[model samples]
Target: MENQAFQIGKASLLTKQSMGEPKQLTSSIVILVLATNIVYISNMLNLVTYLHDRMHADIASSSTMVTNFVGATCAFALLGGFLSDSYISRFKTMLIFGPIEFLGLASLALQAHLPSLQPPKCDTVNEWNSCKKMSNLDASILYLSLYTVALGEGCLRSSMASFGGDQFDENDPIESQQKSSFFNWYTFDKSLGGLLGLIFIVRIENNKGWDYGFGVSALVILFGLVSVASSFSFYRIQRPRGSPLTRLLQVIVAAFKKRKLSLPENTDDLHQLDIKEETFGMEVLSHASGLEFLDKAAISHGSTGAWSLSTVSQVEETKIIIRMLPIFLSSLSCYICNPLLVIFTVQQGNTMNTKLGKIHISPTSLVIIPLTFQIIFLVLYDSLFTPFARKFIGYRTGITQLQRISVGIISMSLGMCVAALVERKRKRVA
Candidate 1:
């Protein structure tokens, strides 16, 4: 009965489009992001080491497994977003995926603790050549747990930022500014959690055991789930916005079905909704010239329409998304290149000095150096730089999203060059 009432209340909130208060945001999305980063970053950053040292896998095998796991997690984000927009609301998506992540973490902790569940650990690195490698059963269990976590993490991430941003209304200039600053600080909180994960959790895994480290991570996620659940009333549960996939498919189907018909000459001939009468707040996109084939989708054929007809707004929206594909594909180069650099650097750092007096630092923990800088940079960018730059740039958040992506690509190439030079210096010094 209580659960039923809670569900009803959530449904009401969904319809209302309630804006989350600051206190509610702190307990829910803030904790969710922070907890997620801490648990995931700590585990994934040292996953290769765990596979090689504890699971007794070769370096190449360990790296491959880690890379694939990372990639799987990213891919799951697409599925999650689709589910959120199409069927279940984003809040519900988070609720469902959060527990799945917890189960994965718990299972991993169990596997790490029990020697019977693990392969025979090599006594020395040199012994790996003669070692049998991780048993099939052990490897299967590891994969299951890792992918389970990946699915949950990916889905959760798909909704997390969007959910958080929805809390602040963009209509009010103040709330709009808060929304911009909110993401920056949200990232800072997440980075701070990751920094702790690297410095503290990694050390625990190194000094104590993977079991203990994973156990703590599981507990943190559990707390995060509870936090999200407890803050249920405070959340602004948005109604499911119709899926982009469905819309795109509709456009394609409409276009194909109407392929035999000739297109109307005037851009205004394309079917469009009366903005004042139909659309409330939605932006009615202007019909763009490029994808004229898609314009067939917006053709008003007979007196009636179903899947074979679409509005100009719908067709234009699909066209815009299609146009962005090139930029999206181009961005993949950074993801492909940067990950290899990160994995290689972690391997290299393992051979470097990791001690500060009595404290023995885990090589994986060295990531906190970059994370620390990131946190500081975010603070300065949001508090100092963005406002200062807004004076000249004439845009919110200092620049467009496209400009940011371009800058990220440039930075990725620079980082690779710097890393190559640094690796040479380290080799010569050694």
Candidate 2:
């Protein structure tokens, strides 16, 4: 199929007379995030415990299981991106994926609730073979259900933020400013949900049971779906503009095909959108500096076919992605082992004296510490740090994206080091 213009280039602003305004869109998204994230955070923070306590996995095995499940959920986001851009609108992608997640949560609840679906709980599962571990069939059932949840949540992760951003008209001055603030609000909303999940939901799981927790999560996601549907008529749906990966590949193939072509004296000689097509809704990216080799794709070749020739804008998009590759690759290092901290913390808390008067502390609820700090940091960075940093190195965000990521990487490393020291000290004392 032909590309439906590139990357939501121009939205036609489809809407009912009084609907699809920013106010309505904002409220809908707030509800959606609150409903979606609280449960997501609760499950993520508690999944290892569930697998170990309910599913009869050991500590190491439980962490590995939870890690793989989380990784798979992130991986399936690629499907979300591909389909949302190439086949369906972001709204529809949410609608489709939401129910699948609910099903998975429901499955997990049923499995945890029913004794037949679980392994026999014992004092020492693998020590002296006092009791059998989880059966193979039950393990398969668990994996299937967990993977189903991963698929659904992964796709929703890809769509939700972008769908909210798509509501504002970037060209309009007021909306553009609002668009900038929209993401900050999105972050706040997400953190609020996470805080609630970390504090309240985890407490429920510890006091009540895993089945109750999973059941609650299922209901929350279902509420999110209903919220999204309530404002269905108000969403300014982003038109799918084909797979961006496909466009990038086209640039590579076209450049390779025209490798022998000479560079143009004037960059204007490079092809962009056709005049008639330009009027219709294609994004017009001007030629960017550097990566001149890829510019060959825009040279006027004998064939008019897409594989033989690409627009200058398309080639520039390819160049932008190429330049940003290092940042993306390096990001893995920042997150890869960081999640293991949670598993360790949960286990450590289990061994600690967790009583505060009459209150019994849930180990997972410790996430509130970091969550509180994050919110404080966000506020300080925006209100205080921005002004201070602007005097030295000025940018709208007060620093470049690269700088933020670099600081984050360093902070994460420091946090890990501290965790290691604390764990080492605890071991010595024990």
Candidate 3:
């Protein structure tokens, strides 16, 4: 009887172990992410044209609207991240938001399909001046649908990445190393999804109709939601780690309240979690130097435990975020290229001969050329460039993260310069 009981317990443990493996969790997540990107990028790539051609908006107005929409969608990720870490789990966030995304896409598809929702066709070439303006009702529906999609996207993006990372047990060195590889594959999947959307879905919208294209997007998201749901049992869900914002704020408030306190001489005097065995246990970060002012928060005051004291780890987390602020701000500059490239490329396509043999390609579809190049370049960088750089520099990791970021910034600048030169030439020819 004792031997049988032990065998049953061992079997249960093995089952649980197999269920939480990265392979089982990551496959479902990649599918969901790929589907979501296909829907998102397909709609976004044609949004400017949708506004100008379907809604009869002017060039400047359409461009501004697209820019504002993109900015709002990107900004919503912060709110999503905060909510995921504070109140709800990442799994719950995605589950709730996925349907909201579907509703938004469905609304857009319905509006496109129904005749009453759209304005009458205009003679864009000859009677361009006499084009009818969009009704308030139509405008309202358009804005509502677009912003709803943005909100859903905001809720999903940050949480999804963190959620994927949570599947791996970071305590295991092998699993921890796989986390970086998971991120690389995640990015690759995103790029591939976007490329497919640009090449196929955008082309369908251009030739077939907006309704069909949006309908495809709506269906893809529905499939994604279903795919995610199927993996519910396998996912290693993490509980909310109390609000990070609240913790950061606590550090600030504590530091301010104890402004007159004297600093301790030895770092050991500071309050910190009693963590044992740094290698396999809770990470025990060393005392960071530069932020001397914030370190006062860690000074133990008489037993009132509220705002009077914090752990060294908490103080260091705040300092790390503060230090990273500059890099985050610099990264925002990379987005400036999107509006320039999308808006101008479409305009150039309109004027230039887009015929290749028998097919008449859409100007917006031309954006895929650069996307294709990006995919090829990523492969070369990973396969050819990294090994060469590692051999030359004697660095085990090839190049540091900061150096890679610098290279990206330089590459973006050169691309923008080339775009400007092309635009100049096109204008001269006209």
The TM-score that candidate 3 achieves is: 0.89
Better of 1 and 3 by lDDT: 1
Query: Tens-digit lDDT track for model 2 on 317-401?
Result: 8898998899998878877764775577777887887788998777887777777787777777767886688677755556776
lDDT of each: 0.81, 0.80, 0.78
Error of 2 at 151 (Å): 0.4
Clashes of 3: 0
Question: What residue runs in model 1 are displaced by over 4 Å at the alpha carbon?
Answer: 1-9, 13-27, 129-132, 265-269, 273-290, 302-306, 355-360, 426-430
Off by over 4 Å in 3: 1-16, 276-283, 302-308, 383-397
Candidate 1 Cα lDDT to native: 0.81
lDDT of 3 by residue, 261-313 (tens): 99899988988877762212134777979988999889898644646777888
Q: After superposing candidate 2 on the true structure, give the runs of residues whose Cα lies further than 4 Å from its correct spot.
A: 1-23, 124-128, 275-281, 356-358, 380-400
| Candidate 2 displacement at residue 158 in angstroms | 0.4
Total clashing pairs for each candidate: 0, 0, 0
